[model samples]
Target: MKELLYNLLHGSSTIVTPMDALQNMVIALILGVVVCITYRITYSGVAYSSKFNTALMMLSLITTMVMNILGTSLALSLGMVGALSIVRFRTAIKDPRDTTYIFWAISIGMGAGSSNYYIVIIGTLFIAATSIAFSFSFKKDNKYLVIVRGTNECIEAVRAALFSIYRPCKLRAETVTDDYTEIVYQIKLNNKDQLIDYENIKNIEGVSFVNMVARDGETLG
Candidate 1:
């Protein structure tokens, strides 16, 4: 059993030539860009992160390099597994679309590293086309959490202003204190341009503040 394990670990591995390594890396880079661009094009989130987008691109390159190195040796592959097992990723993925992009980047890297050009090319094109189609077909409404703070006397006025400017406004929360009232509304807009009336809402009399925060579509209600 010991001898078999040793032999398995030290087995004859595929040799990677310099030209092959360069080709794999270049392909991975190109695929990474495609993945990044696809994510950017289909993304409909308030928190559009450039850092995460750049990470997606780099992740493909790094995965390709790791796979290339691992392909050349069985013992090193085992070691890499052990090393990676010790690392912990604490970052949270706020959107499911971002998770899809992450997986796509990794898959592209693996395919490129294994020199599966046809599968990578065809699969990428199909996935990108599908994503674009869905993005256009079922458009999403832009959502915002509108917070209004004002004196008790302005409660009616605040409601009037919100209802006049934004329709279908759902009240998320309402807190009435002895001196003031705080109202939170979840408003949906067909386009982001509809939020341009913020200054008008802020200028209302007795209104302490009017703040709008871009938010996801999900709600507890």
Candidate 2:
């Protein structure tokens, strides 16, 4: 077993040495952790999925393993490809940012597995730094799913109040009752002054209830 490992790592007719493989994989793991951290910091609660987040780390690890195995062997590469062909994935990612992170994880793994420590270290650092910077720089839109119950005539008054306070809003749902009407609006606000909006809606005549619920980036539809 030792001899086989030695050959795989050292006695190979390849550019990567035993030390190189070890360093590569170790760096891959480190970079994988970095990627995970970056994802955690940058992730918005919108459509949050713990499983998908965990898969980013796995993606880095597996890609590293695959690249290491295929290092200098065309035949092994073909076999790996054939083996991987049988695997299937059906889960849909709701966020495009998630896909970008997944691809970044795989790229980090591939670079590390091939003993490109510079690429792994520099690229991972750059991406992670960028993520951190962006997290601080760009804020997610202050979107809210506002639900209101009032008389039919009161809706227009409420809408006018909302329009003045918030940017254009999309009406997601509405229901009419004998005595009152319920309306849901997806609105984005420039400020986090939700209390003011609620107060405005409540002050409207015929308005019975006003609820403003913060929402993560899920579509209004």
Best model per lDDT: 1
Cα deviation at 212, candidate 1, in Å, is 2.5
Task: Note the Cα lDDT for every prediction shown.
Answer: 0.84, 0.79
True-structure lDDT of candidate 2: 0.79
Q: How well does candidate 2 score on lDDT at residue 171?
A: 89
Q: Give the alpha carbon lDDT tens digit for every residue of 1-221 in model 1.
A: 99988778777578889999999999999888888888889887656898999999899999889989988578988799999999999999878778889999999888988898999989998999999889999956567788889999988988987788787899999999999999999887766556676567777788998777766643321
After superposition, candidate 1 runs with Cα above 4 Å error: 1-7, 190-198, 217-221
> Please, what are the lDDT tens digits per residue for candidate 2 over residues 1-221?
98887666555545556777777777877888888888888877756666776888888888887787778766576687898799998878777788899889889988888777887789889989998998989876677888889999888888887777777788899999888999998887676565565676787899888777776545421
TM-score of each: 0.83, 0.72
